[model samples]
Target chain A: MSNQELDVLRSKVDEMNGQLLQLINERAELVQEIGRIKEKQGVNRYDPVRERSMLNNLLEKNDGPFERSTVEHIFKEIFKAGLELQEDDHRKALLV
Target chain B: MSNQELDVLRSKVDEMNGQLLQLINERAELVQEIGRIKEKQGVNRYDPVRERSMLNNLLEKNDGPFERSTVEHIFKEIFKAGLELQEDDHRKALLV
Candidate 1:
């Protein structure tokens, strides 16, 4: 019974991983689009005020088994990923 | 010029936020599915070994500006969210 149980959950986790991969890629695409616009406008890649507000808004809306601090931290990393994408695009634009 | 640049980036951020919201909800849906399966199978909601493996897999695949530790931390919170959903499902089954 325990073996079957573990197998079932593992399968589910694998499936969740795939869904997460897709969503993250979708997010990356949007990040790239935003990065293009940022490059065209000659704007700073990281916007601290906007990021702070986004984190605050997410924290306010959080109803969670996950704590607000955890969300804040994870989201900062996510935002960093977006910034990195923007930086990569900026670098490419410079090369061209 | 600076004001226009900030305004443009803010609009993009807003769009990204909407995309992120959709992705998180999609993740939550998968978590609920796994939770229902766990409830039916009478399994422990938290699986440390599997969670560890998932984090490790993600870390291994990460080619990022986001550090491995950051991914590990975020994933743990995401995993916690999954566990909470399972716990909630377990509780509902008990009440039924």
Candidate 2:
């Protein structure tokens, strides 16, 4: 491929990165909201059963060149980040 | 919060998920292109230096409720998935 072609692909990747960042932030906000509700109900933030089910559902829906394990690992990272965001928000709420 | 509000947040989360899925797929396509180029150049696909630099740049830019480690972990998962996608594409090219 030419330099021009490579540049074009890189630009597209950058655009996707921007979109992913925005969506991840939005997901964090939603996770914080869920955390608030969970705290109010005196429930634990991490639910292993729910996480397992969610991963199973996602993997089932995935039609990919990417393997199921890759998808699972990525989602697990997302899940962990969401959980931490919720916890941080909860801590801030407590301080306030 | 009302049931309606919870529903609203959940719906927003679902919408964000849809966006994330699209962006991730787009990223994967770009990754595959890069893979093809690397294969032609006879270069190793995995670059530890690049991966380290990427994580450092992202963490430096993170103004987050999420910790540095959380961001690092998430990016690592994305990187792994991207790498795997590239390998699979490379293998297919070899067969064809």
Candidate 3:
């Protein structure tokens, strides 16, 4: 590819990466909110059955080049991170 | 901090980061192996109850400057990432 074309492609990739980061951060924020709700309700932050159900639901909905197992793995990590944020918030409160 | 001290600190931080990365990757590999086993056994990849139990166990074990909740959160994210790697491996196999 020409230098200019390469530059444009790089920029596009960077932009896409930025968008993904933003989406991931937003999702994290949502998870934190859920954590707060759970804490207030005296509910546990981790729910494996709900997580499995989510994965299965997503797998059923998936029709892609990406395999269902791969999708499940990615989503599971994302969900795990969300739970972490919630735990972090709770910990901070305890420290105060 | 003195310049030499700062340099030493920075190096230590970098070394710690590297160690963490290595550990994370190692954990990911283990998860991938588990995924393969699960696949053979027709088991689900995501297990929320187990995750919750883990978090609680960790919390009970924690006696540190880091809060139990924070510990839980970090571990949850790590576990989640491991699951993702496993799924990714499974997906690749399916595509072949």
**Residue-level lDDT tens digits of model 3 in B1-96:** 234543453344334333333334444554565566667767787878866765665566555434455455556655666666767778988998
Categorize the docking of model 2: medium
Between candidates 2 and 3, the DockQ winner: 2
Per-residue lDDT for A1-96 in model 1, tens only? 745765675676666665554455555566676667766777766779978888887777666544566567657767776677678678887898
Clashing pairs in 2: none
TM-score, per-candidate, Cα-based: 0.59, 0.82, 0.48
Query: What DockQ was computed for model 2?
Result: 0.52
The CA-based lDDT of model 1 is what? Answer: 0.66
What RMSD, rounded to one decimal, does every model reach? 5.6, 2.6, 17.0
Best by TM-score: 2
> Is 2 or 3 the stronger prediction by TM-score?
2
Q: Per-prediction DockQ, in order?
A: 0.19, 0.52, 0.03
Model 3 scores a TM of: 0.48
Residue B70 CA error for candidate 1 (Å)? 9.4
Candidate 2, superposed: residue stretches over 4 Å from native: A91-96
